[model samples]
Target: MSPLPLHAVAIGDGLTDPATQVLTKPQQAFAFGLVDEKQLAQAQALAQEAHDLALAQRYADAADKRSAMEDLVPLGARNLPEA
Candidate 1:
């Protein structure tokens, strides 16, 4: 028989959860010396754009994986007959 499948898993448990995801906006603002109004606005905008792009990419990837699994389920089911 073939060896058991070893599925890859994320390192951290809840740390990767959306609720716990880190917000680098404030930190970026502080790093960029956001004491001035203009600078603060610019930094906040940049951070927001970056965060949105990252979230979009994550969702796209998840959808792609889910679509791929549609094919895998039938094959897996075929491997196991009724109990």
Candidate 2:
């Protein structure tokens, strides 16, 4: 028998409905210095691809693309560890 398909858990729960959530933009990171436009463009492409994959119900692939896009950007100061 085929195994059951696995899906990602919804973004929020209970009080927050996933359907009501609106994504104005994809993930973005703030850098301490100048950021590369080429990397930004690449990340944007990945974001669009991820959105398309999610719409096609390829959740895992979409998440992978999102992770790749995230890796292109540096973490913001707020997310950095203290020295």
Top of the candidates by TM-score = 2
Expressed as tens digits, the lDDT of each residue in 1-83 for candidate 1 is 99988898656333353311323333433444433465445544544544555577765544343333222223333122111
Q: Point out where model 2 deviates above 4 Å.
A: 1-34, 76-83
Expressed as tens digits, the lDDT of each residue in 15-79 for candidate 2 is: 24211111212323323332366766776677677777777888788778777776675665223
Minimum summed lDDT over a 10-residue window in model 1 is located at: 74-83
**How does residue 75 of candidate 2 score in lDDT?**
60
**Cα lDDT of all candidates, in order?**
0.40, 0.53
Model 2 accuracy (lDDT, Cα): 0.53
Residue 77 C-alpha lDDT in model 2? 27
